[model samples]
Target chain A: MSTPRTPTIGLFGLGAFGRLILRHLGPHFPLTVHDPVHHDSAPPERAAACDIVILAVPVAAMAETCAAIAPHLRPGTLVVDVGSVKIEPARVMQQTLPAHVQIVGTHPLFGPQSARDGITGRNIAVCPVRGRAHLRIAAFLRRVLGLRVILTTPDAHDREAAVVQGLTHLIARVLVEMEPLPGRMTTASYARLMEAIDMVRGDPPGVLAAIETANPHARPVRDRFFATAAAVARRFESGDAGGEDQRRRSRRALIG
Target chain B: MSTPRTPTIGLFGLGAFGRLILRHLGPHFPLTVHDPVHHDSAPPERAAACDIVILAVPVAAMAETCAAIAPHLRPGTLVVDVGSVKIEPARVMQQTLPAHVQIVGTHPLFGPQSARDGITGRNIAVCPVRGRAHLRIAAFLRRVLGLRVILTTPDAHDREAAVVQGLTHLIARVLVEMEPLPGRMTTASYARLMEAIDMVRGDPPGVLAAIETANPHARPVRDRFFATAAAVARRFESGDAGGEDQRRRSRRALIG
Candidate 1:
């Protein structure tokens, strides 16, 4: 049993983002970790029975992990997920976890690479699922962890994250695949784009999959992006960009 | 002639970039400026006959600008261009201008927007065409202008820049057209991408046109990018990304 001051936090999964959470949360809470490999520091039931359960596993493994721990969750305990998407994970947790356990869905905006220095000031979207316990979670994330907490619903979080995370990861995936890019002779925008790519290229593959596939809103955003990008490509390729004089005039007007 | 110590510099096309040049070079040299509009302070012939001539015109107007100034250029005078691409401008200058004048092709890697603060550490590509005078220009750019001058041939500059400027502008173009991108709940990478887009979104349309079409090497890079990006979109849309366990293993491998 945890002391009243320090709650027990059961963290499932030890991936890159999981370790980041561990690094921060370990100082404040008593931790019981479970991983598919040999990193299980406690029994699955013991971890699930803690005061707070944190599922850091991929969306693919959420169902299995939730099922394995479902029977052991104590009444009045809090269950949280740090998935990239909100709606899918929120559904899986709400459906699988016991109705007595409180659920909060959070999407941490910074990746392991981006948060290498620290998680301070980084944004986290907190979606309240089954209970008002999200207020407590959001407060802890805000005051104790030095994070920027955005309280939102599952659908609302997914809609914005569809374009935010979806397009970013998609761009990062393609840019990283196009490696050996020019390191010199780069413009400021190119440098910024490359920096953006660097921040997400090292993200786990599951993160990309979850961002692109798990979120329902990602498809329409992707459709719009590809459609718009293809049109731009065709215009440039066909050399049918708007009239040179008008563009020059507009540029001059802005400059003057 | 003002004095032997201060040579007159003829600046043509007083657009945004031309104004940037005037701001920097005006303090150092005796300036004679000309523009297509009412900003022409000197006769076109007088501007062309200055000791050194700088062309800050668009690629579309390069031929006409060069033809207008060709007959007035003095022997042993130096002519330089600050175009986005090198090969086309270099060809225009070499073919149109008299062989008696020295020519240097330079692409100031930073635009007026990027150089808003200053150009102290920015990059400038110098391609020597018909003269040994590029040596002096490179020295002045390195020493006086505080620019990192990359000396290369027209072909080499275009080849490398095709990827550097080509893809950056292309991506910026598409992303900008996808306006009202989510500002809140943005990841670090998304923020970086937005910064990149902001830096180039205001670019004159001619700059984008020159980067995409005027540079011969841009087409192949664009084709490759579009092809790879399409494949990525297809894979994600079809949900045919690699095996989930494989990705998890790789992510765990990286994290652990």
Candidate 2:
């Protein structure tokens, strides 16, 4: 049992983002970390006994991890999963956890790379699954961590993320594959684009896959994005020699 | 005739980019400004009388503008066209200007928006088309303007730009249309990408059209880009329920 002075936090999955969360949250709360591959990590039962249990695994492992920890959690344990897409994790937590346990679905928009300077002022979206604990957690995230809290539903977060993250990863993957030499010759915009690509350059293949597949809305947005690109490319290729002018006019009409 | 201490310079376009050049070069040289629509601007013949002539028109107007001013230029006058793509403009300058008039093809990689703060350490690609004027111009651009100069052939510039500018504008156009609300929720990369798009958002339709069409190398690169995107999207759409695993494996093979 945690006293009012120091509530124990069990941080599951000590990956890059998970470690980041630990760095910020560990200083304020008594923390116990558990990673499957880490020899130093505590056992699942130890984490389940903590006041707050944060599941920081990849979206693919969310369901399995939640199922593994559900039976060990106490009646009032607060279970949180920080997945990029909220809908799946929200559903999984609601279904797997006991009625007495609380669930909060969170997506920290910035990761280790982005939060290197600091996590202050970064945005975090929270979707409360089955708890009033979210109100207290949101306050803690804002007041202690200095993060901007966006309280939204799981569906709303997924719908917006479908365009935000889906298109970002899609374009970045293609641009990186092209191996563009946007060196010193880069225009201001090109330099910004390259900077964006470099940020996600180190992300794992699994993370990229989950961003594309785990969110149901992401597929439809990806389809529309590629189709729009293909349609524009086709117009450029099939046009007459003098078709450049017509194409310009049409583009203005379409985009403007 | 002008003294070595102060060369009379004529700027023949006062558009956004041209004004940026003016803000930098105007104070150094005895300047004459000309724009066809501006009532207070000097006529073409007046610009022709200057010791150095700079045409900062869009790529589409390069040939016609060069032709209009060709007859008025003195035998020893240096005529330079600051165009984005080099091969076409280089050819236009070489064919239009008289043998006695020197021509230098200059593409200032940074523009009004890019150099808004200042152009110190920015890059400028100079392709020598005719005579030794390029040597002097290059030195002036490097020493006085504090620009990093890349001396390359017109073909090389066009070839590299095909990938750099082509892919940038292509990706930006689609993402901008999606109206991504990348404000506070932006990851590090998405923020950079948005910054890049913002830089080019105000560019005229003509500039976008020229970037796609004027550089012949851009077409093939654009084709490969769209084809690659289509292939990836198709794989995602056609794969079974467990497609994410297969897709990630294939993307690893393809990109890695």
Candidate 3:
């Protein structure tokens, strides 16, 4: 076969993450972007002609967007998604897209700030459906974007993310609700908690909702975090000797 | 009545805070130094003689040190203890010292790193037992050292510190126990926690042990923290249609 032309990138959804990708890859690749809310502000036309189509929308809108874009994609086009919850969107892409197109799901374990700042030392999980397009895309991401691509099943990706992101953010929400932060001269631990809180503080509500509601495995992890915190609290309120006794018993149980 | 001469400062406990004070005040005052461990290796004689008498030792040895140095302290000598816990040491000073020597129990909120550089803008809690030494000490601390003096009862000081320092360190101990951190890229929140852990990482074991065991108020505050964490856990674990059912039930119960 004759040499294949350089792949163009079509990005749908121009929010913070989309904007960052556009900003980073715009100068390198032809980047076309479309966001319903910001339709008039779409990326240049050259970006739309790209063979690679990236869906960078909220999880809620991912399915609808994937279905709508399937007709527009070329026969051999590779469609990839950049959303937190992978399984649902991966399934949607697989179900909606034509047989000639390839579906690859990805979740960049970072935010827009990291991407914009050119900090590429983060993990990006890839769940491929069909064709060598997934591997090609992964290679391009590695060689050009400098992302650490982790190949995994979508189910496993969602399950692990429940604990990693969901549980972490849940603990942060609880801490925020509990007490008024002391003055700046706080212990190192409290400062760390504040940092965690700050990370999740500006996240879009839909992102949290997707992780909390759409991810099938997140509830149990969130439950476990809350349970551990509650158990510690109950033991403390029971009285000094009783609390110490409970702690000792727990330690013994764990060791055994 | 004649105006009393400016009461001189006798710093007992030449650890980080003491050494810092000497570094800053050596040229200005007549400091007499005494550290059982570092008595021979202290910052040359010039910095040592600046103090009227410096008793730099552990908190546990405060009683014996006070008794031994009581004879040497002349009339109007202002002896100050820079221990973390104020109540017990303050009481020890009130009970052990001679009538001519003035005992002022002061805990500089900041530590050695704070002192070696400077003490300006930091807090110093003072529990004055006898003499107008506090006025001179407070003035010197404010003008020369730039310390913000908070005059309070020893009991009150210790009670608040039990929550501030003791509770903080307790949280650090819990977090450290949970995760073995690697030198990989971490989120902002994790970084903050690491900083807190670092602060108490190399502290004198005796200092921590004393704060944990000696402060009677510590147990309860710690207990409350655990209880709150556990309660959050229980809510998560209940699994009665996630948090929705519980929130609805609680709202109904309150309305009824």
- Largest lDDT belongs to which candidate? 1
Q: Cα RMSD to native, each candidate? A: 3.4, 5.1, 8.8
Q: Provide the clashing-pair count of each candidate structure.
A: 0, 0, 33
| Model 3 CA deviation exceeding 4 Å by range | A1-50, A58-75, A84-171, A184-193, A206-256, B1-73, B87-100, B103-105, B109-167, B182-185, B210-224, B231-256
Using Cα atoms with residue i matched to residue i, what is each candidate's TM-score against the true structure?
0.94, 0.91, 0.65
- Runs of candidate 1 with Cα error greater than 4 angstroms are A1-4, A246-256, B1-4, B244-256
Interface RMSD of each: 4.9, 8.2, 11.7
Clashing pairs for model 2 are none
Clashing pairs in 1: none
Interface RMSD of 1: 4.9
Model 3: lDDT of residue B193: 51
Best-to-worst order by lDDT is: 1, 2, 3
Candidate 1 per-residue C-alpha lDDT over A14-127 given as tens digits, one digit per residue, 9 for 90 to 100:
778789989999989889987756553666777788999999888777877788788889999899999988888888898998889999999889978899888899999999
The DockQ-based order of candidates, best leading, equals: 1, 2, 3
Model 2 clash tally?
0
**DockQ of structure 3:** 0.11
Across residues A54-78, which tens digit of lDDT does each residue of candidate 3 receive? 8777776666666666666677778
